[model samples]
Target: MKPTQRLISTLAVVATLGVGLTACGPEDDPYGDGAGSGSGGSSASAQPSKKPAPSDKATDRADGPGDCGTPPKLPAGHKMVEPAVPPSKGSLSAKDAKPVCTPNDWIYHGQGKAKYYLFAQDVKAELSTGPGRTKSVPVGQLWVHAGDCMTNPGAVKAPYTCSGNIYDITLDSEGQINSIKEIWHP
Candidate 1:
């Protein structure tokens, strides 16, 4: 072969070898275990990337406040003070009628933690998305303050203060929702 052709053949062989070696390099391992080098002292699967789980931190809030203890429930006369509304329809002010609570394309108001209330022009049990009276809210029972014009329900914590709104809801002795009043707050 000519000198130039011989040189070209040698260069081609070197290039092919380099590419083969690179293809078998550390990053190419499909299993990602880095097992081929035999330095596999620690398997990738064995060690997690993030820190270990916290013993003190709570992942959920169902337990209660202060990261401990049984959480507070609705106070005594809670139901009697306010009435329960179907969660799907949301709450309303005293001046507002129950039918006003349901609208065909209603807006959502924030309810207790992780919950939302839908206010519409009318709510029909036949037309609602959930059971006759229940929704998959953060908590059971929809509560509305009697006086507050704001439609949102308060958070689930104790002493659920009203923000110029009277939740029309009242609680029973068992802390379950009992009634919703048609009367407005004075």
Candidate 2:
């Protein structure tokens, strides 16, 4: 490949873009994309993204603000960046939304820690891609329960186990994920 072309490809793979929050603040269509008929311009149920997990440093809760406690700690050699959004007519604000407190700083997957930040109650699962919701996966000593991915409603931990590592997540205005979809891959 030409030097210029290679540079472009490298740059392209690094670029991650997201839709911005609407100024409607829960009063209109999401990002005004006309994807649903919920509201002309409402806060819209959370948002989506292609970016590597949106970030806020994980921290120990103290007398003052430190971190939300859910954003995963940066494993060595991993880069975590904020989500980017294009200019929009308006945007919603998650400034008032209280982040759910998590018991652990990192979500342990099979044998290692997961790189994604999980806000269990705030994200939606998109199953059209052939990935189903998990009842809850055992992470470290805590059970990672997601009500959106539950088969048996109200169950804290389902017998099912999460197997895949590929996923697509959307981020909210505060850099927390709002939606997740499992991507099947080989």
Candidate 3:
């Protein structure tokens, strides 16, 4: 063959061998255990790269102030009471005949450590204190227990039973929650 043709043939062979060798390296190993190499050492280093298991740091972040404890049990013979006024079919207006508390007031007002309230739909509060009722109550903190009833108009005609501890809360003049006491639960 001509000298130029012979040189071209040799270059092509070398290029093919280079690609074949690269295809067999550690990059091709799916397990990343350096199984492709006879010495079992990673191409990048003597040791294989290791990833921590998900459970390794799970305990580190398991508990926090935002976490809630086991819910309190209701006393024997204690029964959940229905709200004096139930919800109606309209936007939750402060002017509505019934009292309505905003959801997540505890988080926004920085009340108690409980990260979340249970029956969000059942909570309600009056815009102003009613006669014979303390201003702090219904306007401050209202407790709701499991089995307590609420009306979610247009959804269910009958009163809806709460499944967990819920609280109706009001913010203080400073936009802070007044309390987080558990008045009732089941």
Error of 3 at 95 (Å): 60
> Best by TM-score, which number?
2
Give lDDT tens digits, candidate 1, residues 121-146: 32222111211222222222333222
Please identify model 2 stretches exceeding 4 Å from their true place: 1-121, 127-163
Model 2 lDDT on a 0 to 1 scale: 0.30
User: Local distance difference test, per candidate?
Assistant: 0.30, 0.30, 0.29
Model 2 agreement with the true structure over 1-186: per-residue lDDT tens digits: 699999998776666322243343322433423232121111111121211122322232331232222323332332222112211112211111122222211221222233335444444543222223332222211212222222322443334322223334556666555554432221
Each prediction's RMSD over C-alphas, in Å, is 20.1, 20.8, 20.4
Better of 1 and 2 by TM-score: 2
